[model samples]
Target: MATLESFLKDAAQGDLVPWSSQVLAAQRFDLSLATVEGTILYLDLLPARYQRNRNMISIKQQRRLFNSHAVVIGCGGLGGYVLEQLARLGVGRITAVDPDTFEEHNLNRQLLSSPRLLGHAKVEVAASRITDINPAVTVVPVLAAFGEDNGVEIVAGADVVVDAVDNVPARFALANICGAAGIPLVHGAIAGWYGHVATQYPGDTTLQKIYSRFKNGKGVESELGNPSFTPGVAASFQVAEACKVLIEEGDALRHRKLHLNLLDMEVVDVPF
Candidate 1:
């Protein structure tokens, strides 16, 4: 079994370039490809895998990100992109929960959804995709709806839970579960050209406080329809908030909502 240390010394790329495919495949030993990537990242070798992350994220911060756990509930437009960034950013472990299967309607915004994946489970697809992107990331795919029965256990060990679910009731349920578990929750949603993101810590009723007024059965997305660009924009902000929570960096969206309107090209911060 060729270890990352020996492989690095032997190849001695001396820069950020990744080792040849042959070296990676040969020295991988019993570890999964992701494990190999993780080992290189753990040593702060840069390995081309995370070279761009340098300067932007100190090696210390990268290490912190590599050790964090995030549970994302939903595998649609927002969840798919959130998971993609988390995996690429080397979030150590991710638990993705979603019961829905990919469908034609999701092709526009869901990164893991495609015509060939129409009937496949969304969480499973996300897990497979993450492994392909960054072998160092451990992704746990849970094919179940976020609800009262399994909500707590699903989010139990997570440092942060991302609320990418589309419906109002499901979002509230996830927030309650995360709050009770003392975990931070990053919430995001998009409808047409509009989107919003917020961060809620334990004991915060931000979601309930904001959505309680909307007695409507569902989110505005149903009527307005979610386009490809809206979720992409919103998910980027959601990932930023999640990373901030994970690495304890930057001012978070806690107790505040960032409203984005692509049509009007406006951004506003509203205190909750």
Candidate 2:
């Protein structure tokens, strides 16, 4: 394997190349694509992989994202898209927890679910997808339920936790775990044309306060099955929130929820 410094010198181009090209160069050098990317970044040269992310986030923030660890519980609707975006954004490592398999019903919105992947474990599919999206991203797929017993351990050492679970009870459990761990949790839920996104930090009771009425009951998603767009939109919001927290930029949805109604084309930021 060639050293990263020499590889960068050999592959130096006057113009930026796409991520796929970077991957090919890394393969030729028998090096991880991330190593090439980091070397290029160290030289203050922008790889085409994250060129678009430059205007929104500084190079330092981009480096921060590459060094952050994010945990996503429940790899289904919202989880699928959240993982997709995080991988593209160059989040260094991700722990994806999902105990379910893809069903025929998941074809509607689950980004990683397809007829070919039906019945496959969600976490397994997530692993494959991120590998293709960005070889630099390390995805640890857990084939277990995130319950009270393992909730704390699941999110331990994480820089951020994402609540992509479908039920209110699981959300509460994850929220409590994150609060106790002092980790920020980005929450997103979709029910038909309506969805919500929130950023909850340690010592914040926003989650408990929001779900106080139905802590033990199923979420509205149970009654109103998700549409294709709802989960996609909500997951995008969740990824954006997580990125902001990781980069420590932008005002988070902290202690507040961004409600979306696609049918009416309106967004309301509700504060607790």
Candidate 3:
């Protein structure tokens, strides 16, 4: 390992060529270079491997993750991807609620779904996948659906709530609980090539209002008939929006909805 002072001294004295090889080799433990006519000759260059070893998120940001907790409802296509991103980002704690099982159709977009996990409960499968990605993340899987009865308690301790459910009733239930708790709710929905995302605070334009008009008297249904790449895109936005809320960053999607039409590659942000 080369010290910073020595490295700087070598650079200032025009000895960087010799120092570079020692620094790279000592730090990476894998490189060897020869010199020919005062020019460096490299027998091998593994940029990807070297980059991976050096890749790291800052400690300050990693500590921020330990201060937050998020709840994700429905471990399907959108929820699956959302969980994966959140866990990868090192969110301290996560509570995932769903009362369904992984099916063959879900493999297309559900991050945790696979042929091997075909009949497993969605929450269980998702939790297993999240733990594999980041053992540091505390994933609590609730093998029960989120309803008025359990919504309030489930969301009370969370700093942010992510709604990736497919049902209008469930969305309304989660929105009501989060609103009462004064927690920011990250909402995402997908239908075919179109998807919508919004960050709603208590008393702001509630999800119930939006779904009431859109669903009318009909029951909730999956628009994609079968899972596809659309939910992955939408869920990614939801995770990003949730993280922004958690970190208290400026200019969140608060009181606004982002609509995307993947077919035409158009996006529109509508304010409430």
The candidate that achieves the highest TM-score relative to the unseen native structure: 2
Q: Tens digit of lDDT per residue, candidate 3, span 1-272? A: 65433433443323223444444543443332211101221212211212222234333444455557899998997998899889877577899999999877777777788898999999998788877765546789999989999888788789899998877888888888888899889999887788889889888864666675664433333534534788889999998888777766557787678988888999998776
Q: What does candidate 2's lDDT look like per residue over 171-193, in tens digits?
A: 88988889989999998888889
TM-scores for every predicted model = 0.91, 0.92, 0.76
Task: Give lDDT per model, in order.
Answer: 0.83, 0.86, 0.72
- Candidate 2 C-alpha error for residue 232, in Å: 0.8
Q: Which candidate would rank higher by TM-score, 1 or 3?
A: 1
The Cα RMSD in angstroms, rounded to one decimal, for candidate 1 relative to the true structure is 2.2
Per-residue lDDT value at 82 in model 2: 93
Candidate 3 ranges beyond 4 A from true positions? 1-58, 214-227
lDDT of the structure predicted as candidate 1: 0.83
Count of backbone clashes, every candidate in sequence? 2, 0, 0
